[model samples]
Target: MIGQRRHFQVAHRPRNDDESILPLINIVFLLLIFFMVAGQLSAVDPFEVEPVESAVDGQPGPDEFMVIVGTEGRLAVNQDETDLEGMARLVAEHLQRHGDAARVRVKADGRAEAVEVVGILERLREAGVERIDLLTVPET
Candidate 1:
């Protein structure tokens, strides 16, 4: 009996490759869900814009319209890229649909040409946008 060989049994099976990464997949999915729920996702602009800094702060209204003017004279109306003519047409259409209460805000890049910015403002005003504001970030 002492010379007899003892048989050892394995208690658990070895994990598969997919099973090894299950915890990692779960963690990644949890992080993605957390950001989607906790983060405030807004419409992105067509191009990058660094708004000029100002000393004063302005309270934006709920019905405000956003107009983006990029450094290279690129224009966007509420995230939709368009030319000056298209912007005016869109602004006019928006006014007709939402009424004059919807104030327009021009977010021009700091390096944007002043003449172009002024021209855009002029075009917007001609489109019957009465209350147009220049959006500026608070100076640090």
Candidate 2:
């Protein structure tokens, strides 16, 4: 009888040194953090007025009147709604009380009609308001 040849076999194990995804994940997380901080830093306060940049730079003093024209053709004094006649009366009264030292600032909504805003301006002018500033939003 011929003697059978014996063979030895070795068990196979998977390689555990793979590290391709670790650096990618770290980079992704760092980018996310950077974007988050940048987004927060870019946040700014909403403004009602869009001031045109000018060479003249100074802060407005007190005794300024703010008139707001709502989209619905409603007139407001510092956010208080007033009708056309009522607005005229109020302006007249304000002028009488505060004298010529009052400054008027008008803020009309973008959707507000030009006629309504003009009417308000005329009323203010008739009421002896000399210093009037129109407030507008800055174009992006």
Candidate 3:
């Protein structure tokens, strides 16, 4: 009796299989909805570009000519690829044709540098474009 040894053991609870994954499912659905709603709803430009968004209600005029600036600063006037000088010449000719009703819409890539955009704007202004509208997507 004096040399007897005692052993001790600790009890552990088994994990329950009754845990529900409803919360996980809910999170997945919420993410799906967020993506669908937050995603871009605007029309794709001729070249791959993500334009800036605006809160204004008015849309770009249909009669106005469009000038697209690529991400790398490539210029396209009325869907015709050209340099800045060429674009200026073309826009000037168009302005003469439309007379006082001439309108120009500039759509530049969001990733384009500010300098590039400014240069394009300056060219348009030099071509006698009194008012140049910047194109943007509506903010949701």
Q: Which one wins by lDDT: 2 or 3? A: 3
lDDT score for candidate 2 against the true structure? 0.70
Task: State each model's CA lDDT, in order.
Answer: 0.86, 0.70, 0.80
Highest lDDT scorer = 1
Question: Per-residue CA lDDT of candidate 3, range 1-66, in tens?
Answer: 688997778787786664567788898999999899877544445577677788875576545588
Q: Lowest summed lDDT over 10 consecutive residues: which window, candidate 3?
A: 40-49
Count clashes in each candidate, considering only residues at least 3 apart in sequence or on different chains. Answer: 0, 0, 0
Looking at model 1, residue 12 earns an lDDT score of 92
Error of 2 at 98 (Å): 2.6
What's every prediction's RMSD, in angstroms? 7.3, 13.4, 14.6
Candidate 1 vs candidate 2, lDDT winner = 1
**TM-score for each predicted model, relative to the true structure:** 0.71, 0.53, 0.63
- Candidates sorted on TM-score, descending: 1, 3, 2
Model 2 lDDT per residue over 2-97, tens place:
798878798888766657678889999999999988887442222342233344434433445677776656666755667777777778777887
The lowest-lDDT stretch of 10 consecutive residues in candidate 2 is 43-52
lDDT of 1 by residue, 1-140 (tens): 79999899978978679988999999999999989986755556789999999999986654568899998778998878988888878888889987958688999999999999999988887778888899999999
1 or 3, greater by TM-score: 1
